[model samples]
Target chain A: GDQVEQSPSALSLHEGTGSALRCNFTTTMRAVQWFQQNSRGSLINLFYLASGTKENGRLKSTFNSKESYSTLHIRDAQLEDSGTYFCAAGSNTGYQNFYFGKGTSLTVIP
Target chain B: AQTIHQWPVAEIKAVGSPLSLGCTIKGKSSPNLYWYWQATGGTLQQLFYSITVGQVESVVQLNLSASRPKDDQFILSTEKLLLSHSGFYLCAWSHGLGGATGQLYFGEGSKLTVL
Candidate 1:
């Protein structure tokens, strides 16, 4: 069973365009973390949301814990943003508990 | 400036052979350490985590064990490998602040191939 469901397993965007990626959880989660896995296989933490929303540069993320979902918005997409984006869900119930979605592969082309 | 490092970027071993992987975190003391695995074309799954030296907990068992020998070091090992063990292994560290747990910081990840 998939605890965390990610939408748009793959996505393509034109430079300067923008879009959003989402992760829906099967149950309430304590927090959510968005990551961009680079070609080097390093997972770069983009945003960590316990609730509400956060914005960094052109990237924005929102976590609706009560709704069991989280979203990541990319604005003015750039080529450097091409990579696999992953959403990991955490819970406050247990120690080091987490759930993950496979990922959303994004590519920005000129 | 906290930095996490996973050793042996990639490795290959045969079935029945012993295996060991290591991760080290610098600039952060007593950070929660975790081991996550991703099979090729599969979703990421957490294997184990440690909150302090000499204490570790397993989230998912894949015939592997993890240990925290020092506040800054975490290790993963198995006495016998299975082909199913081949995948990408990531090491992460997390710390709580302002009464809340923070984002997980991951290393470059170690690739394993079992024949």
Candidate 2:
């Protein structure tokens, strides 16, 4: 069983529209990190959340440790935002090994 | 202020050839290091990790092995490459805080192609 699970394995959004991605953890997680992998294959860190919500530009993320889930929201999507989004959860294990979701491939069309 | 360097960027090699990838960390000391592999269009998979010099732990075996010969260097190598070994290799390091909240920073990554 995968420790981290992401919803809507793929998504499409029209420019100026919005959508949200979610990750559910099977066990308690110490933190969650969201990343965007561009077409060029570079993984860019978006948000690293230990708890609560964080908003940057048109992107926002929330991590609920009690619920063992996290969500990323994108408002007014842009063409450059098209990429694969992954949410990884770090467990309490001493090594802090991260378990990543399969990823949500998002495409924004103008 | 820390930076990770991974090279050679990309490589192409024939099957059965030996392969080696390197990663170096700067501006940090005794950092926890990790190796992750992602197959074409696949999710990231943990391969190996090291907490200190001369101590490496294997998370998944894919005909690949890792070594932390020096405090700031981690190496991933193979005696003979397998076609299944082709993928994007990522080198990451963390501050080694007691909890998992510590963030892990990644290098530029190396892409391998096995012909």
Candidate 3:
């Protein structure tokens, strides 16, 4: 079974619009990280959260360990924000295997 | 600031040819190193990890092996390439145990095309 399940496999938004992407975990996850992958296949780290929420510019993310889920909210989207978004979750004990979501493809149109 | 560099950028090789990809992390010490692979349009899969010199652990065996000969350098190699090995290879480093509290940083990545 997949440890993480990401939602809204694809999305499109007009410039300046807002939307959110989510991931649900099948097991207990102690931490979660959000990433944006550009067309060149480079992954840029967006957020890393053990608990609570983090806000960075037009992006905000929240990780709920108890509920086993995480979300990334994009506000005032821009053309440069077009890319694939992924969330990875990991546990605290043992070998520390981080499970990654399939990713959400976001396209911001002008 | 710490930076991760992956070499060769991209490569095209024959099916039976040997392959080696290198990653070097500058400005950080004793970092936990990891290797991840992603097929086209697929999710990232962890392949190997190393906590210290000369000790590498395999996460998923895709006919690949990794080594940590130096504190800042990690290498992924195979005796012979397989068409299935064609994908984006990423090298990452994290402080501490790379668990709940550790944040991971990734390199620019290396792309392989095995024919």
The best candidate by lDDT is 3
Output the lDDT of residue B110, model 1: 99
Q: Which ten residues in a row have the lowest lDDT in candidate 1 chain A?
A: A90-99
In order, candidate lDDTs are 0.90, 0.92, 0.93
Worst 10 residues of 2 chain A by lDDT: A90-99
As for candidate 2, its clashing pairs are none
DockQ of each: 0.55, 0.51, 0.54
Give Cα distance to truth, residue B67, candidate 2, Å: 0.6
- Give the CA lDDT, 0 to 100, for residue A2 in model 3: 95
- Candidate 2, residues A5-38, lDDT tens digits: the string is 9988999999999999999999999889999997
List model 1 lDDT by residue over A1-110, tens digit each: 88899988999999999999999999888889999988877888899888999999999999998888999999999999999999999876325477889899999999
Task: In candidate 3, list every pair of residues with a backbone clash.
Answer: none
After superposition on all CA atoms, what RMSD does each candidate show versus the true structure? 1.7, 1.4, 1.5
The alpha-carbon deviation from the true structure for residue A88 of candidate 2, after best TM-score superposition, in angstroms, is 0.3
Model 3 chain B: lowest-lDDT 10 consecutive positions: B95-104
What is the CAPRI rating of model 2's predicted complex?
Answer: medium
* TM-score for each model: 0.94, 0.96, 0.97
Better of 1 and 3 by lDDT: 3
